[model samples]
Target: MHHTASSHSGPDHGTPRTVAAHRQAFHDLLAAFARPENTEQLPLLAALGRGLAMDILAPLDLPPFANSQMDGYAVRSADIPDAGAELRITDPIPAGAAPAALETGLAAPIMTGAMIPPGADAVVPIELAEPDVFPVPGKAATVRLPPVLAGTFVRDAGSDVRAGELALAAGTCLGPGQLGLLAALGITVVTVYRKARVLLVTTGDEVVEPGSPLAAGKIYDANGTLLEAAMRQAGLDVLRTGISTDSPDELLLLLRRHSPAVDLIVTTGGVSKGAYEVVRQATAAQEVEFLHVAMQPGGPQGLGRFDGTPFIGFPGNPVSCLISFEMFLRPVLGTLLGSPAPRPAVKARLASPLTSPEGKHQVRRGTLLPDGTVRLEGGAGSHLIHALANSNALVHVPVGTSALVAGEEVEVWTL
Candidate 1:
């Protein structure tokens, strides 16, 4: 059925279809058109949020030796009988000092990070020891330690990490913890996958840039800015963001001009069958297929190729545009571009009865319940950006589920 472009409204505007069908449609589109190719070198400090292309291996064992985990005495388990065995403190070892072999009937004073001498078994913190000052070896120095402590203060070699171990798997996004681990291993350089370059465009005469006077009914260009920011946050590198009037020639000109330089070209608005829909008319000749996807809020989707570049056209409504990105582009491209997969929805019970068309994927904005339940934030409307803003998850109510009564279990995706 052919539907003309209309004003964005609640989730009930389009013909209904299944969630699986919509997801498959997106996957097929990506298979046919998404071909990201770009690479760059970044310092380890700047590598956070970047994707790693190669696996990271530890060249040396973590800790590298058996060392004291605490400040206390290092003693051989054999020499120290049950409780109340006192051995003279023979040597005081501070942190980072090399290990010294233990002689029978002798104890070593070890600090945190110091290697345990040979023949030591465990670590006892200073607080657990009998309180007394110990004489320094070969010098007039003394250190205080609580006496009556048991166990040797030693950390086994390779206890934390073994040498030549795969520390980080390939394709892992280098987050702070991963970066810190690499830094601790003394790695200065790392190979990482490339980032996707996207071309973004905002269309419509009713849209104005920020700081511009708004004629009545005209609004600031929220979709463009919103899409760009969302893409960046997803670890995508936007190549160009252009604003096109409701003219087919201008839109095609801009797309064709920038197609060669970007991995994907994304446009917001004007893909619908509306009189002012320039993107639809222009891209139809470029082998782009327009589909009324089986989903709410973002039903009118256009996917095709311009020359050899992939282009995706989203609905103009602010919320609709963002939803399209999250539901469709962000998931697939994020993975292929080496970004982390979008977190799977947390389990949530339905807080209220939610109705849906017999055959459409309903992405609902809702509050997450403390006990893992989801309450609809407002009416399931695409223009309800306020509700979307407050929501941390999009409850995916599958197609054919005409209605879900309150307290029903549902899968939700964290926003």
Candidate 2:
């Protein structure tokens, strides 16, 4: 057995497709299904990790007015032309309260963030003055300070951002600093793109839910949980449909019922040419096309529209299902959702000799060492879930290379 599904007879289907060709086809399919998510206005505090749907312009200058950056005496720089000059103190200015314009030869006590009084071109910190503290009200008070340059310790109007300037551009991903900037600009609400909603399904007669009594010849379903977690990490809103049995009618019913409510549908297993391939049989008359890509572990792949929603099917193996998602779905989703792409591949020496088929790209689970060497975690079998769990990276052995010796460099994709 080839361990993969044969290409369906259709105009869109091609026999023995290359990995690159399948990836391109998948990208085109995603583009056709890329309906723009509706935007909604959410409170600024509630918009973290969301993608901005529109540009945000500053409504007013940040700070809006000149303010003091330090708790000190506001004075004219010329008044203290020499260090240690004493100036009579006036009323203290608290934050959020206005102060009278400073008279010549006099100083006004000002706290940090207080609006700068008119005609005061400099601030001498309280520690620089003789009293070293705010002066008492209604008492004969004076402050001695060092000579300073004009505009010292002043946060001028629009210093951070000017009014009507671009505060955040459209498609910007909101994080802590971005939210802080919006708050500082006094923006209470923002428009953001809605997250993509996905309907995930896994299919197999031998697959059973975890925590159930173990029956002979039945394996617990791990693909559903694995792909669900992956989808969530990719910023998708996922609805898992548990496991569908080997009944084509049951699977089709589930798909039709949930297809209208989701942006995309993802299914694992049943795409291969095995006798119990329900997904393939269920979508036989639909537009879905099943093909075998030129890659090991995840060669059986399917993509099409079912009930007007985009659908992708993977092989039954847990490792194959994940590899398919990483190779095809992740990059396209990241592009549409404004998230980072998969971790980049790095070159590492092979710690052991390995052999691959002449034409298929082999993806082997492996452990990447700190010394830039990669050791295979499991053999090239699809059912080794324990080996997959023990590995932290995927070592990519490209096509047309049948064998490799130890210490040869290969590209490893970090998990």
Best by TM-score: 1
RMSD of each: 5.1, 5.4
lDDT of 2 by residue, 1-415 (tens): 0111233554224557888887877767766433455667899878777777777899999989899999999998988866458889998899999788899999999999999999998888888888898867878888788899999999999999899999988767787899999998877888877777899999988999999987999999999998999888776789998789999999999999999999889999998767778998998767788878889989988888786677898888999998888877887765554443346689999999999998999999999999999999989988888999999999999999999999999999998
Query: What lDDT score goes with residue 274 in model 1?
Result: 70
Candidate 2, clashing residue pairs?
Answer: none
| TM-score for each candidate, following the candidate numbering | 0.85, 0.76
| 122-218 per-residue lDDT for model 1 (tens digits) | 6556665565444556554423333333344456777777889998886677888888888878887877666668899999888888988999988
lDDT of every predicted structure (CA atoms): 0.73, 0.84
> Model 1: which ten-residue window has the lowest total lDDT?
1-10
